[model samples]
Target: MTDQPAVPTDDPTVLTDRDLEVLAEQLGREPRGVVGIAARCVCGRPLVVRTAPRLPDGTPFPTTYYLTHPGAVAAASRLEAQGVMREMTERLGEDEELAAAYRRAHEHYLARRAELGQVEEIDGISAGGMPTRVKCIHVLMGHALAAGSGVNPLGDEALALVRDQWRPDRCSC
Candidate 1:
């Protein structure tokens, strides 16, 4: 990994018209239930967005922090293709310290989402297979970017693993 620290997390910021445009471009579709820009690129572009617990279409969306940057998404996908998730999940089973930390991450995610609103359908659920397995690196990366380091051990690990491919300290957008 580079000596530079990963991009620091930012508090949720009010969404602007330009932010919506950028998000749409990054996602290749209209973003749904976005409440605020949770993390940004070095150049001030949106990298992660905070979504509402319940969407307008009546869907109980569980993914609170959504990764929008195309470069970061691709990097996470590459890690998944390389079976990083499976490896991490295995490590979680063998590492008690890591498993406990991951459980805390799951609680953190739930507490944060509770502030938005309650959605019974996904009540105890956090993204990226938290507290159990590594299902989606993209979700973990997004959580790391939005929640900052140390909150999500596995998320932080995934972020570090993909540093060579994508780093929030630099803008690829």
Candidate 2:
């Protein structure tokens, strides 16, 4: 990944100049390889960005839906600090149905990223420690926000856990 200037996009999630500016502000750097805004706050600020599978600098970016909202990022961090990932990871080992669902979620993530473009380096890999572990609530929450509820069970759970602190329905931007 190089620190190149963000590439402009014409995809369906194509961002306006204002949107790019806000994204840069939220990320504290230039938002790289962003194709579209996957999720937005109630007030219309970008909450999750749909990034290119391959970056402009020829880096394979496995994370397609990246959470950028400061409030949502902080909420996911708070959940992680509360030992939620350990509990979720433990439950994944004990629940067959949940495990299957998580695997499906992983597949869904891969499929979505495939639409952007095929990146051999990240092929078959999805972010958020999907299918086996609960590594980053930020990634899962980003997926949840981008794909909507029910597509990602763990992501949905993470979103639920942080509802009191942050929610898509509420303006936390």
Provide the overall lDDT of each model, using Cα atoms, as 2-decimal numbers.
Answer: 0.88, 0.86
User: Which residue runs of candidate 2 sit more than 4 Å off their true CA positions?
Assistant: 1-13
User: RMSD of candidate 1 to the true fold?
Assistant: 2.3
With candidate 2 superimposed using the best TM-score fit, by how many Å does residue 99's alpha carbon deviate from the native?
Answer: 0.4
Best by lDDT: 1
- Winning candidate number (TM-score): 1
Output the TM-score of candidate 1: 0.94
Q: What is the lDDT of residue 27 in candidate 2?
A: 95
> How far off is residue 152 in model 2, in Å?
0.4
The number of clashing residue pairs in each candidate reads 0, 0
| Local distance difference test, candidate 1 | 0.88
Per-residue C-alpha lDDT of model 1 across residues 52-158, encoded as one tens digit per residue: 99999999999999999999999999999999999999999999999999999999999999999899999999988998999999889889888888999988898
Tens-place lDDT digits, model 2, residues 1-173: 22221222225545789989999999999999998988777677788898899989998999998999999999999999999999999999999999999999999999989998898888888998887998999999988888878889999999989878877776755
